[model samples]
Target: MSERVLIAGCGDLGQRVAQLLLARGDEVYALRRHPPALNNSSIHWLCADVARAETLSNLPAGITQLIYLPTPGGREEEAYRSVFVDGLQHMLAALTESPLRRVLFVSSSAVYGEHGDEWVDERTPPAPLGFNGKVLLEAEQWLSTQPVRSVVLRLAGLYGPGRMQLIERLRAGLVHAPRGHWANRIHVDDAASAIAHLVELREPQALYLGVDDTPLPLNELYGSLAALIGAPAVPEGPAPAGLGSKRLSNARLHASGFRVRWPDARAGYAKLLDTQ
Candidate 1:
């Protein structure tokens, strides 16, 4: 039987995941506040905000799977909680009657505070240094206690098509990084693919780190990107505030038989810059 999937907080990444699911003959339902005006027959678009429970009363029934990836509107703590915590609560409540088999909650690697030069994995204890991480951690914990099958994917920084803020910064000679700070990222497409892979896994683990195979130093990444775009040399700057330097491992994700298309940031950025 084709699985009925509900993508809560559907956005760019959600749409990519929807495409993958649709290609494999699964029923895809996309939910968002202001849906696009595409007249596609494959995807069913629903209008609702996960942060507001009242707006989600009319969701479709018999949804076999769900993907929750809500983006906050602001950087404040309340904003994070409202979207990640409250929004998830409201969405789950709305889907109470649906036969949900698995839920994929997209989280962030920020949950593992600063780790200096250490390598962190799923077994490492989380000590989020900022409200963003704190709020996400809360949501993950809350979802774990629910009486539903759920998987938490703590993703690294996402970069892919149309997400060129870093490249732009490097081009303008305004980008800098600490001498020894480490960086981790997963292409947006890989993130979507990981979600699709986990959704279909019969015996999936409760948690997994969604990152690529490579974890580069911040300075190295900046330098490579600068050279790739023929930009001026990147300057040395302080590490990102609240995000401590640490290496993230994707060993578990790889062992699960899923591979990423872009494993290194240099290669990913090079491919993206080619079109410019």
Candidate 2:
């Protein structure tokens, strides 16, 4: 069943999500701060900032689903509150007024706080310690109270193309790993695909942990990437005291019939390095 989809914040992740929906023959209405640089007839680009209620009010009616990908300007507490909390309120307000049935909010796994080496699943309580995590938690809580059918995807560190933070550090010869500390990651394409899957299924008020299958020491992952790029591996240090180490379980999503194309960091890193 094809349905009209409206995407708020059609930036990197949002644009990729739009592309996926377009390829599937769905009507895609993407809201961005500016017009897209590329010419794509399948996407209807609307210029509007999601932070403003008035801007959201202008959204076309009869939208079947909505995807919120609002950007947190920085790690500052104020920034997170303004964007994730306030912006979400505005987006939800408009969504409530529309005939939208399903919603998918792309949240972050940071809501887990620092859990050392312990696997976190959808049932784990959110213990957001930092500003970013707190803001996302608040937004998720706000969404949970709404009547609309919604799902919150707590995505791990997203990597691909221009968004590979760790890979960029490795490429720039700035790779430094804390000993015994591991990191979770997922490909941007996979993230977008997960969002699309959730939208299509219209999962109600559910929470999903989006991450790759492999969780390796931060140092080992960097070494692998460095070797792939024919660069020397950077030195490693002791894991930070407060940082936690744990793998994220993807069983829930997999059981839901959504499989990650890049199930591990090695496979994802290979593709990213191959492109370079």
Candidate 3:
């Protein structure tokens, strides 16, 4: 059955999710503090700051699903709390007054902290070490108490147009990596598609770790990306102090019957270069 979906924080990822839902024949209402650069005529765009409940109070009725992609500002813990934690509280309060059924919260895999080359799955207990990770964990806890059924997707490093960290480093000829350090990532499209898939299937109260199937050493991934972009590969330097390496297992998401469009960094990089 087609349903009305509300997408908060309609940035790159949120906008892509809105596009996918609209293409699937679902009614999508995108809420953003500012207008996004989207060209879709079918989407209903609303200007509202989710940081305040008053802005979200008058949402159109019958929203079956709500996607929250909060934007954290400032570096301090207090700032993160105000935007992520406080804003979520306001959103939850507003949703409680509505008939929203499902919610998808986009979180970061940094919630796992530095795992020292260890593999983490959905079953792993959250051990967030950094401020960002801790803030997200706090937001996740706050969302858990809300009445709506929710899915928290702890996404790995995000990469796509205008957001590829590796490409940015490579273009600057400043790829730096300590020996033996590795990390995982998922393209933005795949992340958005996964959310669309879950919403379409009505999966609730589940946590999914969204990551690329392949984990690459920092040096190799940077080198490959530079090669693809026709840029000179930068020499590797000593690994950064305290950098931990870890691989993420996406078997659960795959088993859920959603295949990642870019299963590995290599494939994603190839497409990125092709489109560039």
Candidate 4:
């Protein structure tokens, strides 16, 4: 049976997921405040504010699967809570009577805090440092007690075409990476494809670390990227004492037989460079 997939907070990542579903002939409903003009007119776009429960009635019926990837309205706690927590709560309540089967929450590795050189997997207990992480943790915990199954993917630095702040920074010159801190990443396409793969799985796992095979040193990553884009090498700043220097493990992601086209920064960023 084809799914009625509803994408809440459907932004760039959500739109990518929608494309994958559309290719499989699944119905797509995108809920965004102002959904951009889509190339695929087949996708049904609904405009509503997720934080407000009263606006949720605009949501479609019989949503079998949902992808919650809300963008934070701001960096403050109130902003984070409004979208990640309260918004999520409103969404869940609205779907109470629907046939929603499972939800794939696009969470962040920030929830794990700073593990320094330690390797973090799904087994690592979340100890968030900031309110943004706190909000995500609260939502993840709340989702666990819900009727529907939840698959939480703690993605690392998400990068791809158009999302090129790092590349642009390198071009601007004088960019610096923390001397020894580790940097983790996932290509935008891979992130979207992973969600599609999990959706197709007969039994998807509860938690998966959404990262690639390589967790390169920050300076090394920037250096390679700078070289690829023909930008000047960035200076390296001192690695801070016990900061965000953690490495994420994608062992579980690999165990599930999911393969990313660009498994490392070099392969992923090279494509962008070649296209430019």
List, residue by residue over 15-56, the lDDT tens digit for candidate 4: 899999999989999998887865556889988888889999
Displacement of residue 103 (Cα, Å) in model 4 is: 1.3
Candidate 3 shows a clash count of 2
Evaluated at residue 125, the lDDT of candidate 4 is 91
* Residue-wise C-alpha lDDT for candidate 3, range 1-276, written one tens digit per residue: 888988887878888898899888999988888875665468898888877778877888778888888676567888777767888788767767667888888888878756667788999888877778888899998888866788888898888888866677778877766657787889999999988988877554378889988988877887777888887866878765433466788888888888988988788878787887
**Best by the lDDT measure:** 1
lDDT of 1 by residue, 1-276 (tens): 679999988889999999999999999999988998875668899988888889999999899999999778889999899889999999899889999988899999999987878999999999999889999999999999999999999999999998999988888898888887899999999999999999999899999999999999999999998988899999898888899788999999998899999999899989988877
Model 2 lDDT per residue over 1-276, tens place? 788999888888988898889888899998877776776568898888766678766788878888988776666788778767898888877767678887788898778766667778898888876667778899989988988877899998888889766666777887678766778889999999998888877443388888888878788887888888777677876664434566678778887889999988878879877777
Instruction: Report clash pairs, candidate 1.
Output: none
lDDT agreement with native, every candidate: 0.92, 0.81, 0.80, 0.86
Per-prediction TM-score, please?
A: 0.98, 0.92, 0.91, 0.95
- Best to worst by lDDT, what's the order? 1, 4, 2, 3
TM-score of 3: 0.91
Give the least accurate 10-residue stretch of model 1, judged by summed lDDT. 34-43
